[model samples]
Target: MQRIGWTRPTAKTMRDMLHIGAPIFAELFLVSLFVMVDTALLKPCGTTAIAAVGLTAEPINVLEFLFFAVQTAVIARMARASAKNDRNAIHAIIRGYLKLTLASAALLAVLTGVFAVPFLTLFGGTADTLPIAVPYFQISLLAFVCRRMYGAMATILKGLDKPQWSFLLNLIANGINIVGDIVLINGYGPFPKLGALGAAVATVSGCAVGLVCAVVVMRDQLRAREIRIPLSDWLRSTWRETRAICTEALPMAGEKVMIRLGIFLSITRIAALGTTAFAAYRILISLQNFAYLGAEAVATTALIFLSKAYANHDRKAAQDAFSAAMVYGLAFSSLCAVLFFAVPGFLMSCYSDDPQVLSEGVRVLRIIFLYQPFQAVALIYASGMRSCRRAGIPSIITTVGIVLVRPSLVYLLAGPLGVCGAWIAIMTDEIVRCVLLFALRGKMWRQFTDAPTPSPAVV
Candidate 1:
């Protein structure tokens, strides 16, 4: 009887996971904090403003998926290149994706801005919310290119095992956003109060600064010598790299679209429950983002390690890395669960003082906490599989849970259980995905460890 691969995480493995994961956790925490602060700043404007901003959340995430998909491909390729110490490949991947990110973001931003109202309405925006949401969304779209570029650079840094640089970049950007929200939203000093619109402006400003800083830092870090090439050859190489990125990115983008569609439907159902219910849902989601911060960090860290391990074909090291990531992710999720259970009221109060919102939020938040550990398991294992370049099964599993099962549960349950029912559906979806991913992980371990060294082309 052999022990499982994850049962044997070495001390150095644990140390490495922490070193990489801590900054990512901090970066995510800061980003979530800025969101909560932005929500709080809008409170004085009224619940409609909060709900209006929340209406744009899923849509914005849907837009971001394009950038994230490209970033994922960049990370995967860059990680492999890093493992092989192929500096030119790393530089080439960075250059190709930066161009793709900018062009795509610019075009998407224009289209989304042009059809802002229809887009918002499609995502469950009520008449009252649309007037506010439309302009806020359009203004926020100004940040899209900047956000995409910054994200591209950050992913590159992380893939190269330089997460601290990414952390610093986020810290500066989020700090600016926090201060800008305070000044612009409330009319501080020379700035006029613009309410929800102010939040959008602050976001644009922060992303712009982050993008500039990222470009400068990336240039300094790479320091690759310029190799003169024929113009035609350069264009050909760029196209080839871009095509490779799109090849890996398409499945990931499809997965994201399905997941966002499910969320869009769920939010629409919650919005149909009326403004107060929707506002409460928004606040709870923000708090839920906190719970996910560490899990995402662990998953990302595992992805980087696993990518390198796959390149090296070191099964034991890959196993140890996965083990450490799960341990850390579960531990952090348990801590968040305890907090959610212990002080649900206090957490909800930070965003809203309305009795109806607080009562509903506290109830659903308690239910939400129950799924954290399971959710952590699903995220980490799915990411582990993705690093193995076995993303198709995990993507299929996620699509089924999010696209089909979760939304169906929401539709069936929301009528009987109210907003709480929707959350219960979410929890059930996480549990289902967790169980499936666990089984898939076992199968992956058997195949991966038993197999001979894989070809570089496959890896």
Candidate 2:
């Protein structure tokens, strides 16, 4: 009867999330690494092949980001419900989002699979490159529908405030990918000889595994439900909320689309410089993905706490979580930033055996590092915004900063400044978000905290 905190996180909350977040981070990092491994193995196949895979990745990232936007909307709803202790709603949200995600995945997979060849060709793959691209793209399209299930499951786990399970699944999934990459890409022992296709197969296989695991998890939870809840019920009850979430998500999706486009442009700029630069850019992007895992984890941590606090109407707790995240996120980001700049060669050195790739990549590493502090600020605050369900404003900021400003400058500057110019563009975009969000979050948090019957830290 004396529940003080609207949603009280147990000792298990931080611990579990870290468990979940870390593996998710590591798995993605490993997946990125597998690409590097694929490229490394494929390097001997020739530069044209590497460029083909690299080029195909841009549209793939765009596609994936769109799905991510949907997941974000679903996660926002789940987090809100978790905060409110609406357990019944939680189950329905899970089933509802599952239906939405599966239908979308099925349609997109078919379309992408059907047109895979042309899409890659349009991206710059030549006849020789197209052979590799086609198989790889075909594999990607098939596996990705299953991948969306993993994505949705992971989000549901996180939304349920069980980040640990999400992380565990990723860890297991990454392990699967890394092993498959080693064996399939290089044809270890008895594995049949396959090239880029092998790598794609391996990657898809790993995601499929994740999908199965996700299904098992869901089944375990719904042991009591006789049927996966009907679509009609969801439309009647949650269609409005789903629409509201998607409305918020559209800007966020647009912003991420811009990022994918900008990065695609950056890759194009690098490719224009020729093979060495393109290979280097691929490695650099992979490394950047690894480096930003910390930023993402911290941001996610902030988002969870904010969601819980806001649901409970606990302004003090929300601020506490926000303040703690900035300090932690900044400190962690600064450390990685130092590593990126101070010894980038060491970082670049991990993935490739080529000297030219190392040399070209190391040059822009520092520029990317410059954005780390700002990246931390922006991501953490953005997470807070997502929690507050004011995702639209930050979404606008991100779209302007990432989609519009960054790519335009990078495209214009690339001819003169080379690869480094494109990275500088990336740094600038992040800083813009940092400045803009910092201006907004504090003022907004004040409103929630200034309300009556102050939220108790513990229930």
Candidate 3:
């Protein structure tokens, strides 16, 4: 029988690569669109509404990355489990991680929900923005458990080479969110016009539905053995496994949180520039994310393939996976760059009609064109590094760039260059990050060259 990871690069390999990546891209695109929906829906309530959303988003982004660290850790380990064809190992990994995640999530929900106002205030909440932002943030925090669980399950599906299942489920969740946004934001059909609070309600409601659906879909897959959910030793000690995951996951979580903190601090500075600038920055980020998400999806697909191949002792397969990932990732991001450069106005119009917001958005977006290609490399290589557990240098480098370099440049340059300086600082950070990641590529793959392989048996 031909082994799955032994195939050399060919048209079929490329096709398979795309087949794995496209749904991931769609899922990422939909996630970004979910955020954009909030921004767009609230546009009618004025820029204050937009600013409140933006402020509230930073803290949420930080929290998401905290769980994202867990997801990344899960994907890496699960990929190896898949490669070994060991159902027991995969089950054990999931069970320990999910329990740890649930307990942590419960605590996080309590802390974040209880201190929602103080957290928002620290991020950039003004007296004006607080009244609207606090309730929205608190309500959203209440759904953190469901949202984090949904993400964990989706990561498992992806790690198991079942991206489509998770994508379809998320699409359903998004549909529910859209309906809630339309009716609740404007009080349509007896839904109260709660503005920002309504948006939060819609988001939480979507997550609740998503949690139920993901659990069901994942359960059905387990029954078919497309995924293996073992029923044994349910009360066994998982401390060792849980500790290993946490050790690997904590650095990643720290790196991301540090990066978010820098951005949160930067947001405070931008907010001081006035609401218009703050809102424009938010819109610009969403636009850039449309491009970033594609790279992210391609990176994720590569991570799964590379990790699996490494586990199977197939070095060539890992290399081929990275090559295919970069080719597709760069192509997608390059197209986004072209669109942003050629028709910035058209993209901006999707979110706002205000003349000032449009102008500032265009200026900042054009600046992003210089960084998009480098962004692709950074994301692709970073994924490979993290998958192989070579996260130490990558994490440190990311922290320095996002937390130290970018903000320092912004402080020094934003005075003379205005918002363009902020964008320029971002570009410079990506360029530095690309150079570092490229430099470390060899080290990233070297660790995997001698990795131990496990049995293909259930026990």
TM-score: which candidate is best? 3
Note the Cα lDDT for every prediction shown.
0.82, 0.72, 0.81
Model 1 over residues 241-337: C-alpha lDDT tens digits? Answer: 7887888777778888888878877877888988888888888887888778778888889888888887777778788998899889889899999
**Each prediction's TM-score against the native?**
0.88, 0.83, 0.88
Off by over 4 Å in 1: 1-4, 42-58, 120-136, 185-198, 224-237, 274-277, 450-459
* Pairs with backbone N, CA or C atoms under 3 Å apart (clashes), candidate 3: none
Cα lDDT of model 2 by residue, 75-181, tens digit: 76677667776666676677657777788888877887788877777777787878778888888776778778887888887777666667667666666776786
Error of 1 at 124 (Å): 5.5
Candidate 2 collision pairs:
6-312, 20-163, 20-164, 20-167
Give one digit per residue, the lDDT tens place, for model 3 in 1-459: 221222345666689889888999998888777766667788788888888878887688767777888788889888888777777777777788878878888888789888888888888899989888888888887667888888788888888888998788789888888889888888998678887788889888988999999888878766676655556655667777788788888878888888877886676666677777777887888788888888888888888988888778787778788778878888888898899899999998988998999998898878888789899989888888887777777788899899998888888777677777888988999999999988777777675676555434332
Which runs of model 2 end up more than 4 angstroms from their true locations?
A: 1-21, 41-55, 178-194, 221-238, 273-281, 351-363, 411-416, 450-459
Which residue segments of model 3 deviate by more than 4 Å? 1-9, 42-55, 124-135, 185-198, 226-234, 272-279, 352-363, 452-459
The lDDT-based order of candidates, best leading, equals: 1, 3, 2
